[model samples]
Target chain A: MRTALCSLLDIEHPIVGFTPSEHVAAAISRAGGLGVLGCVRFNDPAELDEALTWLDGNTDGRPYGVDVVMPTRVPTEGTAADLDKLIPAGHRDFVESTLTKLGVPPLPDDDSPARDGVLGWLHSVARSHVEVALAHRPRLIANALGPPPPDVIEQAHAHGLVVAALAGRAAHARAQVASGVDLVVAQGYEAGGHTGEIASMVLVPEVVDEVGGSVPVLAAGGIGCGRQIAAALALGAAGVWMGSCWLTTEEYVIGTAMPALREALLAAGSSDTVRSRIYSGKPARLLRNRWTGAWEESGAPAPLPMPLQNLLVSEAHRRLMESGDPSVVPMPVGQIVGRMNDVRPVADVMATLVAEAGETLKRLGELHP
Target chain B: MRTALCSLLDIEHPIVGFTPSEHVAAAISRAGGLGVLGCVRFNDPAELDEALTWLDGNTDGRPYGVDVVMPTRVPTEGTAADLDKLIPAGHRDFVESTLTKLGVPPLPDDDSPARDGVLGWLHSVARSHVEVALAHRPRLIANALGPPPPDVIEQAHAHGLVVAALAGRAAHARAQVASGVDLVVAQGYEAGGHTGEIASMVLVPEVVDEVGGSVPVLAAGGIGCGRQIAAALALGAAGVWMGSCWLTTEEYVIGTAMPALREALLAAGSSDTVRSRIYSGKPARLLRNRWTGAWEESGAPAPLPMPLQNLLVSEAHRRLMESGDPSVVPMPVGQIVGRMNDVRPVADVMATLVAEAGETLKRLGELHP
Candidate 1:
């Protein structure tokens, strides 16, 4: 399964595991694949720095990556309080009313800051994520939405870090490569969270053709098992970037903190997810649950654009998670949830992927032999 | 390039080319692959009988197949006239007004029966198609929606014809296998025309896991080039079933009859299509154009159910074709349209697919060796 990606990323396997949990990320790096910790959930810079420091120690001297979300077009810069005021009153009311209708209990009053309004999706916060990541020993910095700003790319290069960007279209991949990204993750429509309308089978090759020679392409979306990884390689991708498959991994923070969500994902089928804008005001794939269904009802308010939509639903998302009801919680997962049928340690998953890919490649080789 | 599908279907390559033209079907069969002629476009039994007769003589004694559209559940049986009457007046007006707005001119008066109301989607019409196919020498009979009815399956088996069905979900494949289907075409969301929401990468392995040992699985959707065919095999499919890839083949009817439509397809990219119910009451992927755009506008009437919706838009489709304008014509195609950039003979396409798959397999083989 070795490819140019293994040499470039300094990993044993050509698989890149993406998860928001620092624990899962470290385990993946230790297991011989690149583990990219998603930094968008860390609204506070100090928290991201702490997580990266933990990863640096736990990875046993192996390389890991950090991913941040920054829109291709820089959004309006504003403070959390300023952005909060921009959310419409009606949108807030709709969220409150929907939560009440669904009987989602509110968070218990505590001194801890509410984990609402994931301000990390904003450009400024994501820039800070890059700043924190550069101070660590990570080897890669990935932009989830588009190419990192040129200055950020230059800074990462100065620190000898590879800068990769996720693209849903061939044009986007071309744009990312032109902007000096080291690698392109061709994330398809079937991927979790924000994605373009092209599926992996078509998108990977298109992206590969667009930028494979300049920058190795990593196929993503609906890729869970080793067969998919082999297929990705056949489609000209240098590697596979997987996310939703890790949601059920033992090291995933959600597996223990949100047992119901993990179970729901394990029990879901490919069709159980839907692409909708309710999650982030941008089109994204999410588990088809009560939250999405409510937003879909006739006369329901249309999701506001990006930051506003995420802000509007952030509290409701928090309440739904507190409710601990799997059917109502908003979870961003890919169609590959159908294949994540059970919990496994990151090492075990990595082993299975490597073994299965080897077997698949051997069988494919026999066809031509 | 060989698989169980090749042995079962008596073809040299594990590739199935699906097209509506008898000429294309015969060409594919002659090129060492199974060519399944889509029978849904033929409303008149005599016409289909003639087409099959032409295929019988033109395929150079090579094996071929016929595909018919039959919903899993039987709908109300009626003459085409009765079905046309069932279409709402407002739906008719909406179609008429939209066509007028798009400047699609009316067809010139001709003795050729109006090609409106594709009642072939109904059970009775599809059954008639099966009867016509059985009278011919096709090696296989496939139902597009689900398993052929039990009697039809028995009839096809009695006639020594293989029974195949297209399935979008694992359960659908299970059902088709249970109903004695010899093969399952796991059509994914990125496929042309009518399809399920699951993409081929997720759906193929799921279906293979469900019924591969019992019945061979053919991967469909988002498959155009040879690399995709190789990837399909990697995903555990016995072969690849392609539809949209054939639309630009020289033998396809639209190439000569509607050059603009063919040109539009050649120019399209992976993101140029959208899945909408406006094409047929059921959701089908169609080339995004003025027709689909009009249906999506505010205050536009919801598409009626399958038969009624087809009946409603049938005349509008006729007018769009007559207008010789590609931008307003309704063409059911897949995301793979992005790769169909040229016109070639069916033999050339098949040759390219085989050569590409062979190269891909050889390269993949080296990885493990």
Candidate 2:
């Protein structure tokens, strides 16, 4: 009844459910697996505190983790002499003109959020969010892009929390382990949010071989079933970390537009979705749409760096969120959307995946050994 | 500066590629555009000889094509299926043993003078090939995956010919498409054969839009690349037809690995890659490898099928091609691998994807209000 992964994380199953909502995270934990709350959008310190408080009250003492976006490169992390001096105005203008052509209207008069530039916003939110998450005793903290910043990692270990980071390739996995991360997640493109080019089938094994078990690799991206969960362990993964499968669950708060788009995705071939910075300045896969079309218009300007470009598109996203229009909105999702076909409770979803994987393993075990 | 793809086929550009290597038939032909070749390992007399002769020799040498398996697949489709199928049962052991325990042997004594199946000995010979080339008159035939099937499409089209087939995705522009095809290529996972899954990177347009006026659509597996290709044409595509991109890649080929594997696959994510052949009966991008490893074991049964499974792997496949060792055999080649990284070549490979699409038509003086 025990899985190597469950043993690794001291849980009933090695499943780590990834969701942007605190409710789903707590529910998964209560269901006897780890719940990872996505914190990429938690731009304020107070919000992190509130989410943790909510999770604490709801989980009834179950374990959970938190995820944050600590990208490979922070625009502001470069010393004044590093990038600020090297990148020129022409590049910046080229970016401006590009967004302008894409119908990126000027910042509206009613909003005054994050006046901070790209570098400033990244630094501020990343720092405050990590600090806030640490305040609560989350079992793990995963950095969506890279290993947690050194300071963050130092603080987490000091508090007995394990640190994990997402890696899109073999090289990235090596870097993550060298940074002393507790786990390395080799995320396949099928994952929601941001991911890389390799498939889970190939990437996971390559990473396991590369990391050589120095760190446990929890496979991420498109892992939604028992068979896949079994395969990950067969491929040497200690656990399976998922995101999209949770999107349509009852505990997920995805709105009408997203749910509708997600439904349409069920009929699509896996290749139908695309990864474009049009959603965030960095590439993240989502359903293709007209808003992406306009921004991607042939010679459209380059998207500005992370937070700035994200800031510009945030308005379009807000409008779409408000209007529920599929035509001009950026739906943050992954190739795994094709698999999130039904609405189930987070607990049911977890149980089904684990149960299925166990059956698959048993069947495999029945085979010639 | 012109490619045989353009000059020979008389298409706007030389980007012709990814056609099934059948004897050339459609609901009929010239859908106004053309489809080339990908990874096809099987060949009956009617198909190999007839398909090539017709695609290249007929069409007024207009610009149609044929593709053969690279020197890999059956290495020598000429292997004796009858005798090979008679191998002892012990050789088919993997079916009775665990994969980790299978003892894959070294390469066999490959002294045969056959031209087809696997290593493509037929292609390595130039005389029988030159005569074959002269037999057909096609425009442009290419050689990759170890030189296109001999007599290639170009040799015939010269009597008038326009031929092209699939290539590796990394070669999307620089290598695969750059050298020349009258057309270019950018295939994604939804494809068959051995493939890598990196969502077309908006690759269709990157290649289509980037290679502007150079080639047209021939989109591959996932050509069910659909409204997306509508976007492709918006990005610019002459036409679109797909292969595994369609299970019935024209419907002629469908096999047993059906139902369970297929259903399992439907429930699978883009992250899935079954190097096991729930299909090839061997283990290909199948549901799992347990079945495949069962065959690769040292004392397992022999493999059957094209070129005789190339070795003794299973009762079904094992009886077909066991010369001694298939572990030393060549693997299949299809452009779609699973998504190890999220490049989404679909709409986002390059910035010029759409604009240049406009520019391409503009330069061609084909614009409309």
In terms of TM-score, the best-performing candidate is 1
lDDT of 1 at B8: 96
**For all the predictions, what are the DockQ values?**
0.81, 0.02
Clashing pairs in 1: none
Candidate 1's displacement at residue A311, Å, is 0.9
> B316-349, model 2: which lDDT tens digit per residue?
3321123222231222322232221222221131
Tens-digit per-residue lDDT, B194-257, candidate 1: 9889888899999999999899999999999989999999999999999998888888874234
Best by DockQ: 1
Model 1 C-alpha lDDT per residue in residues A1-369, reported as the tens digit of each score: 789999999999999999999999999999999999999988889989999989989999999999999998766567767777888888888888888899888777872555357788888899889888888988999999999999999999999999999999999989999999999999988899998889999999999999998999999998999899899999999999999988888888742337778868888899999999998888999999888899989879988887878877877777787687988868999999999899999999999999988899999999994
* Chain A TM-score, each candidate: 0.98, 0.85
What TM-score does model 2 achieve against the real structure? Answer: 0.52
Q: What lDDT tens digits, residue by residue, belong to model 2 across residues A239-331?
A: 788886776788876544565454555444344467777555677777666566655666566666666565555544654544444454566
